[model samples]
Target: MAEKVTAYRFDRIDETLSQLNREDCAIIAGGTDVMVLHKSRRGVPPKFSKPIVFIDHLSELKQVYQTDKDLHIGACCTYTELLEHPLIPTPIKSAIKTIAAPAIRNRGTVGGNICNASPAGDMLPLLYVYNAKVLLRSVNGDRFVAISDFIQGPRRIQRLHNEIVTEIILPSVLEEGTHVIFEKVGNRNADAIAKVSFAGFMRINKERIEDIRFAFGAVGPTMIRSREIEKKLVGKTLPLADAEIDTIVAEFDKIIRPIDDQRSTAVYRKTVALNLLRYFLSLKQ
Candidate 1:
């Protein structure tokens, strides 16, 4: 026999939080990930120990607004929503377009992606490099956490039972002339999970490297980034020598730890990742 699951639906954020405070509850926004994650076999209900609060329809969780310093994206906003919104950065749109086909994009929310915390999650590498922040809300109040700190490892996150990630904050401006490269090595062009992915941002001013950032996914426990290595490239003039590129790639090679998974092998992922890094650095020449 299946135990009955209690599901709560609210039209307002405050009401949702009020209900959430009475007991530990799981939040469902864009239930796409949750449904698949908790799917059961042959019509049998998967065991769910926590009550569920459905906030997908709440307006509070579907907004996109910008302040002087940041672009605020409601956690429930779907990939399609962000794609259509003009304020979304090019890098974000580039990454979102690579996600599953239209059906999944229409239903999948970035917030769900953040909470899932998969190493291959398409949004993670971009978010990590963007210096994005995740906002978690509860009856107590609101809290913001750096994306890197919020996502510890595969399927691991820092959310409390009472907290729901309500919004994502992104910087309002990307420096002009920034070159962004986002590549996903997948089996197919569309609707394929990334075997390995890389997102690199570089800005060159008068042939001098003004800023550079590299983040790799599916190659580490969390989105992998090294501030130390990025600092080494700052102010270095472009048309870098082969030896310079090799040195940077070698440094990244040491940190790009991958594992053999059903989707891909460790060696393949590592090789593709380094290749992508080399390609990103080869942009100017």
Candidate 2:
């Protein structure tokens, strides 16, 4: 058996940051992913090589607010909380609904999903399409990074040992989207991990595509989103939608690099991804 790790819970943010300098310590909130990764036998406590600092109880890190330019979702906010909040947009709510069962959603958190850095994380594709950013903090100071840059690759994040993600920031303009769509393909309807998933949104005005976004999960090192590629459809008229859809699909195909995993094959993922893109485009009409 591994040595039992100590757990710390602090009500104050200041007290939490004071203990964050140690490289051997881990930060945990919902324990949704952490507990699974450090699992032991069925009847045994989870095996841990480092101590855990629980921050879910900190009220300072559970805020949800909006400013002139952005919606700030605190790191400790759970999936259930966001689902119930009236301010959350349809695109985000749709994605969160497909995550897991009610019990897991009640405990799993937004920050946990982001920091876990899994390419298949359901929330990631929407976060990428919505122009989200992550707020990282430490005793030294605070900094914000684009979500695309923060989650470097599968199971990898750019956070330092001393830094903790305090919030997930999204552009306020996302709430005004004219249409939104989200879909996750998994083996089972409940508690299944995504084999391929997509989150997209667009605003049409006077029969012209004013704005559009697309992001795909479980099909790349990180969730695949490219602003340069999405520009192809923006400002296009509805009459040109059919032809443009094929062009957009081809553009995305070049960047969606998947690999064979226990859950799925690369070819199946790529085929379904492009098909979903086609279905999403068809809806634009």
Candidate 3:
């Protein structure tokens, strides 16, 4: 005999939170990754083992609004919705456009993507570069955590079982003349999981590199970014000398640790990550 499953649907945030606080339940929004896990029987803490609380229909978690300093994205907002919204940053838009296909994008929520915490999750690298924050709400209160801190490991996060991610906050203004790039290599073009992915933002002023941020995914336990490496090139002049480029590439090679898996080899992922970074930097000239 199989275990019986119980499901609860709530249209209000408070009601959902109350249920979450009182019972041991899994909170589900888009059900994209969760469903796959439930069907495949893979991953830690097997899916559908406990009661489920569905919050996807709550209007409170489906909004996209902005303030003077930040843009607030609701937890249940879908990728297609974000892509269609004018307030979404261009870099973010570029990245979201590459997720799955139209049908999957229509049902896949940004919050779900973040909470799923896949190493190759397309949204995370951009969020990491943007210095995004996640807002978690529980019956007890609310808490905010940096994107970097929120994701503890592959398929692991800081969110308590009783808390729900309510919003994702990002800076409203990015540096002027910043160039952003998002690149991914997968088994196929559409709907395929990434073998390796990279997102970069750089700004050059007067032929001198003013600011730079780089993130690589599916090459580490979590999305990879190094402030130490970024600091080294911040004030350097562009049209970088071959020696300088080699030095930066060497540093990146040291940091990116990949593993051979079903999708790709460790060697292939590391090679592509470095190549993409080199190509992105070359575009600044």
- TM for every model, in the order presented, reads 0.95, 0.95, 0.94
For model 1, state the Cα shift of residue 56 in Å. 1.6
Q: Itemize residue pairs with steric clashes in candidate 2.
A: none
Of the candidates numbered 1 and 3, which has the greater TM-score value?
A: 1
Best of the two (1, 2) by lDDT: 1
**RMSD (Cα, Å) of candidate 2?**
1.6
Q: Mind giving the per-residue lDDT tens digits that candidate 3 earns over 71-130? A: 999999999999999888887888887879899899999999999999999888888888
* Residue-pair clashes, model 2: 0
Model 2 weakest lDDT span, ten residues long: 171-180
All models: lDDT? 0.87, 0.86, 0.88
Tens digit of per-residue lDDT, candidate 1, span 1-285? 787889999878888888888889877778776787888897787556799888878888889988986989999899999999988887779878888889988988889889988898988888877778999999999999999999998889999877889999987456576777789988998888789999998878888988888899998888899999999999898888899999999999898889998899999999999999999888873
On a 0 to 100 scale, what is the lDDT of residue 158 in model 3?
98
Clashes (candidate 1) = 0
TM-score of 3: 0.94
**How badly does each model clash, as a count of residue pairs?**
0, 0, 0
Q: Residue 55 error for model 2, in Å?
A: 0.9
